[model samples]
Target chain A: MHLMDTEPLTKLDPSYSTVMRIEGVLALIPLLIAGIALYVAAEVPAWVPGIALAIAALVLVFYLPMKRYRSRGYHISDDRLRVVKGVMFHADTVVPFSRVQHLDVEQNPLERMFGIARLILHTAGTHNASVTLPGLAHDNAITMREAIRAHVKRESL
Target chain B: MHEWLRVNPLSMAVQMLRTLGSAIVPAAFVIFGAGTQDSEKFAEIAPWIIPVLVVIIGVNLLGAWLGWVRLRYRVGEADVRVEQGILSRQARSVPYERIQDVSLEQKLIPRLLGLVEVKFETGAGGKEELKLSYVSEAEGEKLRETVRALVEGETAAPAVAAAGEAGEPAAEPTGETLFAMDTRRLFVFGLFNFSLVVFAVLIGALQQFEFLLPFDLWDYLADLFRQDTIAQAGDALAGYTLVAQIAAIAYAVVAVVVVGMASGVVRTFVQDWQFRLDRTAKGFRRRRGLLTRTDVVMPVHRVQALVLKTGIIRRRFGWYGLSFISLAQDAGSANHDVAPFAKMEEIAPIAREAGFTLPGESADWHRASADYYFDRAVLQALVPGAAAMAAIVLGYTLVGLLLAALAGVLVVGEYFLWRFVRHALDPQQVMSRVGWLAPRWQIANRVKLHSVEIAQGPLARRRGYCTLRFGLAGGRLSFRGLSLDDARAMRAAVLDSIAAVDFAHLPR
Candidate 1:
C-alpha cells in the first residue's frame, strides 16, 4: 500500500488562525516601534512608516499564517507517527511507536486562551528526538497522547 | 529501599578543595597584578589576602558541609533515587533498565583517600543522571554491580534472580582482555594524532606578554646578527640579511612543530596510558588514563552502533580507531575509544566481540547508485556554485571566484568519494560505508534501529531519488541518492528485520 496516498492527514484546529493572528500582532509590535523610531529619528517622509506598516500587516497577519497553516499536517500509521511541515523547506518526520520515550501535552497561556494545545513526542536519539505538532485541539491532543502511549505499550510488550 | 545513605563525610573536604581550586586561578591573577604595582601595594594587598583566603575557604567548607548534609541517595530494586539541593529539595529517580553505563573515576586525592566517584549515565541528555562522589572504592564497586545485576535481571528473565538465590553459582566473571595499548602503541597514537593549533595559540599568548619580558629575545638575536659579531665569526655571511631572516623564520616554524608534536604525545600518553578493554560476562569494562583513572562498564546490548574511523594520515598506515555509539552521551566521548589505532585486519574480530560485525564481512555489499554523485554534487557543489555566482553578481568578484574554485574542487573530491558510499544488509545487521579522506564505516545492528526514514527533498523528488536514514538508540546514519524504488525496498526490508527481531525477543 502506498503510505502517502492513504487517507489525508489531519490538519490543525481552525481556531489556530486566530491564535496566529494574535501572535502576529504581538510580534509586529516591536517592528512597528522600530519603524516609527526610524521615521522620527531620520525624519523621512510620513508615507515610509505607512508603507512599512502595510507590508508588516500583509506578512504577519495574512501571508505567513496562511502558508504556515497550509504546510503543517500530521498522520498516524499503525507503528509510526509522521509530521510533515515547512513550506519552502519541507520536512517529513516519521517516528515509530517503539522508539518513543515519552509524550508531553502542553498548553501555553496563549494556546490555552485559544482552546488549543501542542503534542510533543520524545524519541531515543538526540537528533530529532522531540517531534512537536502544535495547534492540536485540546481534546485531540489528549486522545492522541493516550493513543500513542497505548501503542508504545503494546509495541514494547 | 527508601532509606537514604550519605557519602563518607570526608567527601566534604574534597568538594571544598575542588571549589577553591577553581577560584585559585583568578585569585592568583589578582595578586600577580597587585604585586607588579609596588612593594607597598603588594604588602597592602598581602595583609588582606590571608583574611580573604580564610573567608573563602570557610564559606566553601560551610557550603560543602551543608550540601553533604542535604544530599542523600538510595538504590531501589527497580530504580535509583537521589535527593539533593539544600534550598529547593530536588529529587530524581532513574529506572534501572534505563541505566546505560556505570562509570567509576578516581583522581589523585580520591585515589590517595581510597575513594571512588561513581556516575550513572542514563540515555537522557540533560544533566548527569546521578553521581555518588567520594564513596569508598568497595562501596562504589558494590553499587555498580548491584545496578548492573538489576538491569541484567530485567532483561534475561527474572528467573536469573531466583537462580542467584538458589546459589546456582554466582555469575562467572571470567573477563577476557579484548585489547590493550602499551607505551609503544600509545606513542604511535600520539605521533599520528599530532596537532599544531595548541602550540600556535600558546605562542600567540606569549607574544602578547613580550613587553613584560626582562630581556628581549629579539634584541639578543639582533645583537647576534650585528656586523661586528658576524665579522668576529669569520665574516661568512656578513651582508646576507635575506638568508638570515629566512633561516630564523624556518627555525621558528620547526620549533613550533616540534613543540606541537611533543604536546600531542604528552596528551595522548596521559589519556590512553595502559588503556584496556575487557569483556566480562556482564559487558565490556574499559579502564584507562594515567593521572585520573576512569573505569566504565558498558553492557553489550546498550551499544547502539560501531564506528570505524580513520584519518587521512592514519589511513596511510592502515590504522583505524574504533568507538561505540552508546545510549549514554558519556560513552560517545573520547573515553569510549575502544581502539586508538588498530590494523585493518584487527577490526572485524574486535567488532565481532561487540554486538555488531564489520561491514562487507557477512553481507552482500551494494554500492549506492551512481546518482549519489549527483546528490553530493547538489549539496557540496551546485549550492555553493550557485552562491558563488550570486556573490559575483552582488559585486564580490574575487571571493565569488575563490568560492567557485572551491566548489569545483569539492565536487571532484566527492566524485572520487562517491564510490566508497556503499550499504549492505545481512540477516541481522545493517552497514553503511562512506568517506574517502577519513574513511569511516558504521555498522548498526538491525534490532537496535528505532526508526527508518526515507526523505525526498524537492530536487530528489523530481530526480526520482531519496535519502534513507536509520535512527538507532544514540545516533543515526543515512545513505543518500537511492532510486525511489530501491529506497522503498530497503525501508520495507529494514522494517521487516525490526519486526522479526521484536518477535524473536517476545516470550515463547
Candidate 2:
C-alpha cells in the first residue's frame, strides 16, 4: 500500500462528547458493585485500586471523549457521503447517494435536548448497509436528508 | 394463478400434523417426568390424560383450520397481495418491481405430499415475505413463472449480468451444462469432507430414547472416562506387551477413520446426489439431493463475488470449491456453490462464464506491511510466553516448557502465514488470497462494489498502514494492513468504479 493523507471533512458538534461522557458514567455502576464486594468480602482498605479505577473512569468520562470528538467528521460531496470516525481505529467510509435504499433522521432525548440529530442512509448492501452521521443540528440533518433524497430521485430518473 | 384464492385444504391437515410433531418432545418429557416421580403420580394423572390429549388435538385442529380459512392471496398485474388474519383482516401488498424473486421450497413432508412452498422474496430481508405453502408442484411453478415474467419484463434483468465484464452478454440459450459431478468424482470429494456428525446424531437419539436403553448411556460413558477409571485403565495398559498395545492403538485409530469417512460419504451422497448445475434463462439452476431435494436459481448480476477455497488435504491435489456469493442464500451459507469440489483447471471455465478471470502467474501479489506482521507476531507470542512464565513460577515446569516452545514457534510462523495473505488489483477486479494451509481466494468486480472503507488502528495510524474493506451485497472482501497511502488509493479507485455505473440500471 501507498502513503498519503488529504482530507476535507466537516467536524461534528462539540456537545456530542458530553453525551459520550454521560454514557461513560454507566461504567461506574460496576465499580460501585466491586467496591461493595470489596468492603463486605475483604479486610484490606481498597483505596489504592479504587483510585486507579477512578482515574481510568475519569479519563473515559472526560479526556477520551474530548480526543475522540476531534476525530469524528463527515463530508458530503456531489454524489456521495463520507464518514470518518474513531480515534483508535480510524474508519473512513464513502457511500454513493445512488446506492441508498432509504434514509432516516432520528434523535434520542439527549440529542433532542442538545438540538441535534443523526441522519442514517440505508443501502441495499449487506455490509455497512446503514451509514449514520450524528451530531448534526436537527435542521441540518433534515436538510441533508432532502438533499440526498433529491439526488437519488434524479439519478433513478 | 392471478385470482384471489385459498390454498389446498390439505394444508390444514399438514399444519395440524406439524403442530402435533412439535408437541411430541414436551409430551414425552411430561410422561417421563410423571413415570419417574412417586408411585401415586402416574395414577393421579391417569384420569386427566384422555381429556388433556383431546384438548391438545382440538386446539391444534382449530388453529390449523383458522389459518387455512383466513389466508388468501392474489397475484395481480402490478403487485402480489396477501390477506391473512382471523379477526383483524390484515392485507399487505408487494409491487412486482420490488419482488426480487419467486422461489419454491419443499421440506421432507411437503415433498412427499407433492406440495411446494412458494415464496416471494423482496430486496429488504431474508424470507420476510409472503409464503403460499402446500400448493401443488404444478401450481407453484406457474406462480413462480408469472412473477418472473412480470419482473423480467420491467427490468430486463433475466439476462446475464456478468461481473467484471463491460456491458451485458446477450442472454444465452438455457439448459447449458456448465458443471457437473458424477458419482466417482463425488466419492473423491467425499474423502476430503471427513466429519464425525454421526456422534451428534447418536447423542440426539440417545437423549430422545434414554428409557428404551438397557443401561443409562450417559452414566455408563461418564463412569468409563472417570479419573480413577482412566488411571486403572492406564495401569492395565502399562502391563500389556508393546506389540499388542501398538496393534490395539492402531485398531482404535482405524475405527475412528472408518467412521469419519463413512459419515462424510453418507452426508455428501445425500446432499449432492445427481448434482447438476445448468445455465437457465432465469439464472444458474442447481438441482441436487437424494431425499430432501433442493432446486435453486441464482440470478447472474446479483452475484457480488466469487470465492474459490479448498481444504488443507485437498489443496495438495490442487482441488478447489468455487462458489458464487449471491443474495440466493442457501439455508445457512451465503455462497451458492457452483462446483463444490473440482480441480483448479475445471473451475477456471466456470469462473470465466461468470465474467471473472482467475489470476494468472503474471498477476502482481502484495502482502501486508512487514511492520504489521512483526507487531502481530510480538502480540501473538506475548500471551503464551507470559503464561509459560507464570506456569513455570507455579511449578508446572513441563507444561510451561511446552507453552514456551509454542510461543517461539508462533513468532516465526506468523511471518510465514503473512506470506500467504496478499491481494492483486487490476483494471476491472480485485482479488484477495488469504489463509495458510487451506488458502482461499475472494474476487469481486470493482464496479459491483457498493461502498469502500479504509480503517487504521492506533498502531497502524502511527505506522502508516491501514485495512481496506469493500461492501459487496452478500459477500465479504477485505485486505488487512496495507500501506495507508495504498489503502486510500484503492478505496478511491473502487469508489470511482462504483461511481461510473448507474446503480438504478444495475441488475438485482
Candidate 3:
C-alpha cells in the first residue's frame, strides 16, 4: 500500500502550517479548562491523570498540524483542479472548470496576516456544492479564481 | 404576447384566513390569560370583543387586498416575470429556456375554488424554484403550454388547450397510458406497503384530547395490570381447551394484521389515488393525490440518472420501484418515483425511456474488494465488541453477552451487505447495486456528473482502497471500497467524458 499518489501533487504553503498550529492551540484552551475543572471536582484524585492527558494533547497539538500540512496538496491542470487534503480522513476532490458556477477568493484576518487566501468554487450539485482550496498564496488564489472564472460557462442552473 | 395579470380575487380571502390563522395562537393565549388571572379585566375586555374582531377582520382584509393589488405576473415572449412586495418590491423572471418543467398543485380549499398553483422547476435543487399561486385551473394549463411551446422554440402555431383532465398532454384520449394504477393494483400495492402509522396517530390524538376521557389512561392501565385481572384471566384461560386458546391467539394476530393493512390502504388511497404517468410532448407527466392533487412534468432529456428500489417484503413479491433522478428535486426526495410499485418486466420500458438498462445477462458487474468490506465489518463491530468487554468488566454478564451477540450479528450483516454490492461502468454510463435486504440500484450518466471525489480514511489508506463519489445535481452515485489503481482509472475515464463535453451547447 502506497501513501502517496503515483503523480506527486504540489504541497500547500509552508506558513499554512503555522496557521493550523494556531488553530490547534485555540482548540486546546477549552479542553485544558475542562481538564482542570475535572481535576478540582474529583475527590481524592492525584494530579497524574490530568497531567498525562495534558501531555498527550500537547503532543498532538504540535504533531497533528504538521501531519495534516504534509498530507494536503493541490494540482491545477488544463481544465480541472484536484485538491487532496486531510490526514485522518483523506479526501481527494476534482472539479472541472466548466462545471464551476461561480468563484470566490476569501481571506480571514489570520490568513491575511499570513498572506494566504482560500479559493471557493461553487457548483450546482446538491451535496459537495462548494469545493474549497485553502492555504494558497494570496496573489496565487486570486489568479486561480480568475483562471477558473474565465473557463466557467454561465448557464441557468 | 405579454399579459400582465393579478391572481384570482378569491385568493384574497384565503390570504386573510392564513393571516388570521397565524394570529390565532397568540390571541388565544392573551384571552385565556386575562380570563384566568383577572376576571375583571376579561369582563372589561368582553364588551369590546365584537369591535376588536371587526377591526382585526377589517385590517386583515385590507392587507390581503393590498397584497393582491401589488402582486402581478406577466407572461412575456421569452420569460414569465412576477413582481411583488409593497415597500421593498422584487421582480423575478424565469427564462423559458431555463425551465426544466412545470407542475400544477391544488390543495383542498384551492381545489374547491377551481384554482391551481403553477411551479416552474429549474436545474437548481427544490429550494429556490418559482411559484404562482391561486390561478384558474385553465389559466395554469394555458401558461404551462405557452412555456412549453416557447421552450421548444416557437412553432407554426400557438398550442391549443387540449381536452383532458386539467388540460392534459395533447396525446389522444385513446392513446396508451405509459403506466396507471387502478383500485385493484393500488390495493395490492397497499398490501405490500404495510405500516402502523395509524396507531401512532391514534395515540397522538388520545394524548392531545385526554381531557375528554372519563378516566385517566394511566390509571386504567394500572387497574388492568393489577394482580386480580392477571390471575383471573390466567384461570379463565387455563379452563379453555388447547385448540380454543390457539384459535384465540390466531384471531388476535389476524386483528393486528388487519389494522396494519387498513392503515396502509388508507394512506395509499390518499396519496396515490388514480396515479397516472404519461409521456407527453413536454416529458413524463405524472398526476396523483386525492385531496392535494399534483401535476408534474420531467423532460426526458433532463433526466440525469435512474433509480430502482424495493423493500425486502416487496422484492419477495417481485415488486420494484422506478424513479428518475432529474434536476427537479421532488419535495424531500431527489429521485422522482415514476413507478412506485411494478415488476422487473414492467419497469424495463420505463427504464428504456430514461436511457438505462437494468443489470442482467450481457451486463458485466465487478465485485468490490474483499479486504475493503472485511476491514469495514471488523471496524464497525469493534465499538460494540469493546462495549461488551467493558460491560463484562463491570460484572454485567447478561448485558455483556447480549452486546456480544449484537456485535456478531452486525459483523455478519455488514459482510452480507458487502457481498451483495457490485458495480459496472462503461463508456456510456456507471451503475452500482447496494443493500442486501432491500436492494437499491442507481445508474447515472457519466457526462452528467458535476465533479468527482476520491476519499480514503486511515483504515482504507492502510488497506490500499478508496471510495469514489460522483457529484450529481439532484442524486447520489458512488462506488465505495475500490483499489487505488481502479479508482484512478475510473476517474480518468469519467474525466475524459466530462472534458469532451461543450457545456455551453447543452440545454439547461
Candidate 4:
C-alpha cells in the first residue's frame, strides 16, 4: 500500500487532559484486580511475589507508550490530515480533509494544570470518526482549529 | 382554556370498569384454583377476603377517576402542551417544528362514545413524546388536521379557530366517519395463511395464562387424532372410508375458508376501523386500531428503505403489504417496533408522494455487482444448517441413519433459501433481493449510506472471497458471495463516492 505524503497544515492542542488521566486510571484497575486475585489464592507459590513484581514492571514499561500517546501530534494538509503516534508500531492515519464534520477543543482538570488542550475532529461514519491531538498550548489549539475550519470550508466546497 | 372542547367524564369511569373486568377473569381463576388446592385454608379466609377484594376494586375506580381529572392539554401558537400525572405532576411541550408525524386512533367503545385518542411523534427516543387519550372524535380530527397543516407549512389561522371551537362548551362533528376495508381484499389478505393470527392467539394465551386450557384449539385437534374409534373405522373400510374421508376433508376445508374470512373481517374492522394515512410536509401520518389505538408519523428523509412483501396466498390475488424500516424514535409507539406497518399496494403511491422510488421500478437499477451471483451458497447457508442438525442429532445420541436423513433435508432446505440472495450495486445506489417464498427487493441510495464493511471469515479466506455490507442510517444491505478482489474494489468505489458526493445536493 502506498502511503500518502504528510504536509504540515495546522496543529491542535485539545483543552482536556482528563483523557490522559482516564487512560491511566483504566490501566490501574486491571493491575489492582490481578494483585488482589494473587493475594487471595491460597495455592499461590512463594515466588509469586517476584512474578507479580515482573508484571508490574512490565506495566510500568507501558508508561512509555502512554507518554508517547500524550505527546502524539497531528497536522492537517490541503487534502488529508495525519495523526502521528507510536511506541513500537509507528502509525499514521490519513483522513481526507473533506470528511471532517466538526472540530471540538476540549479541556479538563489535568490539562488545566499544564495549560494545554486536546482537539477532536469528528467525521460522519457508523463508528465515530475522531482524531484526538493532545499536549498543545491552549492558544495554538485555538489558532489551529480556526485555520483547519477555514481550509475545510474552502477546499470542501 | 376553550370551553367547548372536552373529553367525556364517563370515559374514565368506563376505562376503569374495563380494566377491572379484565383483571377479574384471571383473578377469579387464580383464587378458585388456589381454593381448590386448599379448601380448608380458603374457608378460613373467604369472608374477609371477599370484602377486601370489593374494596380494592372501588379504590381502583376512584384512582382512575382522579387520574382522568388531572389529565388535560392545551394548544399554543407554536406548540402543544400536555399536563398529566396525578401524583408526580409532569408537563410536556412539543413544538411544531420538532413534530415528525401525528396519529389519531379510536377504540370500539371510544368510537361509539364519540371520543378519539391523538398521538404526536417527535424525533425523540421511545414513544412517550405526547398523547391526548380522551378527546372527542371531532376534536381529534381537528387536532390532527391542525398539526398536519402546521408541519406541512400550511396557514395556522384555521388551526387557531379549530382550537377555539374545541375548547368551546359545545358538541361538534356529530357526523361520524367510519373507514372500512374492502371485503374481497380483506378475505384475500387473511385467508391465505392463518399463521399470524394463530401466532398472535398463542402468544396472548401464553402471556395471559400459564397453562394451556384443554379446550384450546390445538389440543382439540390432537385429541381428534388420538381417538381409538376413528382409527378403527379407518382400518375397517379402507377404500370406501378413504373416499368418505376425502369428502369430509373437502368440507372441512370449505368451512375453514369461511371461518378464516369471518375472522379476517372482524380483524380488519377491529384493527383498522378508523385507518387513515395522511401526507404532510414533514412525512407520512398513520393511525389505526380500535380499543388500544396507535398513531405514528415517520419523516420522509428518515426512511432508509422500503420493503414490499406478499405471501403465496396474497400473491395469487395481486396484493402485497408495504413496510418501511426507519430509525426508531419512540419506545411505546408502533414505529419503534421491529415489525413494519401493514398496508395494501397503496403504499407505493404514498412512497412516491413522499419522494422515494419503489425499488424494482427505479430506472437507475443496473445489473447487480458480480459478487452476488457466486456459488457460495454451500458455505454460507448450507454448512451452518447441517452443522446445527448434526449438533442436535449428536446431542441426543440419535441413530446415525436418522441423523443423516435429517441433516440431508436441512442442507437442501438451506440451499433453496440461499438461492434467492441476489443483489446489485451501482455508483449511486445499491439493491438486494432475498427471501424464497416471499421475495423482497430493497433499494437504497448511496447518499443515505452510513457505513461499509468488508468481512472475510476463515472459510472465505480459503475460497478467496468476502462479503461487503452497506449500512444505511435506517437499515442495512449485505451482499455476500463476492471474490475478495471484487469486494475490495466495491469498497473503494463506495468510499470514493462518499468523499466526492455532497449528500445535501441529492434529490429529495
| TM-score, chain B, each candidate | 0.82, 0.86, 0.81, 0.68
Candidate 4, residues B1-508, lDDT tens digits: the string is: 3222335576786677678887777768767766876789888878877797888788878888888888777767678888878899998888887776666656667767777777786745455668777777767777876676665443234544654565731222322221224445444444553433644786787766754232455566678888866787677647566788788779878876676666766765555545656554345656656565766656566666666666765555565656666654344323432123344445556657545565554444333233333344334555545655676667844554455565566556556655555665665566677766776777666655644555555555555666666655445566665665555555555555654654343333
TM-score winner: 2
lDDT of 4 at B502: 45
Estimate the TM-score of every prediction: 0.77, 0.83, 0.82, 0.64
lDDT per residue (tens digit) for residues B164-208 in model 3: 334754432333468888999899999877888888999998887
Q: Please report the candidate that would top lDDT against the real structure.
A: 3
Residues forming the 10-long window of minimal summed lDDT in candidate 2 chain B: B163-172
What value does the lDDT take at residue B292 in candidate 1? 87
Considering only N, C-alpha and C atoms within 3 Å, which residue pairs clash in candidate 1?
none
DockQ of each candidate relative to the true complex: 0.29, 0.41, 0.41, 0.13
Candidate 2 stretches with Cα past 4 Å from truth are: A1-4, A13-62, A108-115, A137-143, A154-157, B16-69, B84-90, B157-174, B208-236, B328-330, B386-400
lDDT of 2 by residue, A67-106 (tens): 7889889888777899989977789888987777788999
Assign candidate 1 its CAPRI class.
Answer: acceptable
User: Where is model 4 more than 4 Å wrong at Cα?
Assistant: A1-157, B1-8, B30-54, B152-181, B196-287, B290-302, B310-319, B327-351, B359-419, B425-428, B450-471, B478-508
lDDT of 4 at B262: 64
> Which has the better TM-score: candidate 1, or candidate 4?
1
Residue B84 in candidate 2 has what lDDT?
A: 88
After TM-score superposition, the amount by which residue B199's alpha carbon in candidate 2 deviates from its true location, in angstroms, is 1.6
DockQ of 1: 0.29
TM-score of chain B of 4: 0.68
